[model samples]
Target: MIDEKGILFVLSGPSGVGKGTVRKSLFDRATDLKYSISMTTRSIREGEKEGTDYFYKTKQEFEDLIKKNRLLEYAEYVGNYYGTPRDYVEETLDHGKDVFLEIEVQGALQVKENFPQGVFIFLFPPSLEELKNRIINRGTESEELVKNRLIAAKTEIEMMDAYDYVVVNDEIETAVQKIQSIVQSEHCKRERVAKQYKKALEADFS
Candidate 1:
């Protein structure tokens, strides 16, 4: 079999758009793609495992990584730092296993600049009003924080043009279905599959 490099699929959107939820649901079912774990300075939450949820780091450690350019993209949100490690992603793709990155808008943009070939998908809320409700419903953020998130979400939504596809998060199952379909379609693109076929043809001639 021809070994082709794997695709990087980035899932990002406004703060309250359910990117994480959708990603979890997609992975819960059978799939071949690997999840690219992010590193964070924030304290691990309940039920979250180290390396699985995030590679937890101290502020100083995270800053050192920044200095060394070990991270593909990093962002400071609220009071914590979050980023994707460059080595793991590159190595995984080289091994022909697809990678899925569920990240925030800023991080996603940074990844796009570094890896333009990635499939960027923007997960959108059904409505701005619904987005607001979702953020508020979390009960973890202050009223002021909720307002700030909504503002940020509005700006991020405006940047949807930067993405290759938009999947509305009105329903988790529907969004997952659409995203799955997109990944399947991307793999079938002639430009991608043709390379392997061309190699096979050359081998036949040899």
Candidate 2:
């Protein structure tokens, strides 16, 4: 068999663009890709489990990891820290398993810088009005924070040029299907498959 390193797929977009929802739905049906678990200093909720929901850590521990350059990207939110662990992602990729990350725009950009070959996808809302409504409907954000989020969303949407694919989150099922199709197409890309094919040919000749 031809040995191949796995691909890193980063899915990110505006805050209220349904990145998490689409990701969860995609994983519900697809089994080949492994989810990249993030480390966080946030307290685990009742329904959450360690190593599954998030790799919980203390603030100092998280700071130590940051100092050691163990995280690909990190951010502070609501007085808690959250970040993607570099070691886990690298090990998973090296083992020939595709790794998926669903994150925010800033974190996604950091991953792109670290892994330039990663498949970066930008999720988009059908409209700014719809996005605003989604965030407001959550009822978790204060009115001021909601306004700030909309402003941030506009800026994030402008960064769509950086991504390899753009999928509109009009319908959950449709968005999931499009993302799956993108992954399939990426796998078939000549640049990704050629190396393995060449190795297979070399082995056959030998």
Candidate 3:
């Protein structure tokens, strides 16, 4: 909410949810939106680009960033460290471009503390059973890991009230449209336009 800066739109949810897919569709439709790339200590997988996919860093480097308060939020997941660097988001926002972040619930909460005015959107799966199926279908995790994620999803969903908005991902298109509308609405807030109003009034007085 800095003067003339852009909104820090945070998208967060448990694993296997379609947060990434929905985020992609949103930016595809709204090309003006900027994506915040995350930094990770995890090894790069096949077909993943350095900046586009993630800013892969060593554990020591990531820890140094944390020590310097350069990272907005960070957490270890499945033995890999991941975090959102504050500089990129702030720089893009200062340029008057909205930046989007896809993070987990834990990391999102941290952002909430640092950027209270940020737009927090929670993406929900159609159902827990379907969520489990989606994770299993990914074929990345074992049966036990899938079960653990499902258990965690339930707890995460219960905290949905903590977010500014929640969209049920029954259909990706519908979800994207709803989020798009939310952005449009946020841009219309009176406080967001106060600077323009003040400038106009000053000109009249002059």
List runs of model 3 lying over 4 Å from the truth: 1-3, 41-53, 56-58, 77-80, 140-145
**Which lDDT values do the candidates have, in the order given?**
0.92, 0.91, 0.87
Poorly placed runs, candidate 2 (over 4 Å): 43-49, 140-146
Number of the predicted model whose TM-score against the real structure is largest: 2
- The TM-score that candidate 1 achieves is 0.85
Model 3 per-residue lDDT at 155: 87
Per residue, candidate 1 scores C-alpha lDDT tens digits across 1-206 of 77788899999999988888999999999998999988999999999999788999999999998899888799898999989988788899999999999988988998998889999999999998899899988788898899899889889998899999999999999999999999999988999999899889999999
Writing each residue's lDDT as its tens digit, candidate 3 over 82-195 gives 888888888888898888888788889898887788999999998888898899988889888988889899888887777999988889999999888887788878889988
Please report the candidate that would top lDDT against the real structure: 1
- As a TM-score, model 3 comes out at 0.83
lDDT of 2 at 26: 93
Model 3: lDDT of residue 138: 88
Q: Write the per-residue lDDT of candidate 2 for residues 122-181, one digit (tens) a residue.
A: 999999899999999988789899999999999999989999999999999999998888
Clashes of 2: 0
Give the 10-residue window scoring lowest on summed lDDT in candidate 1: 1-10
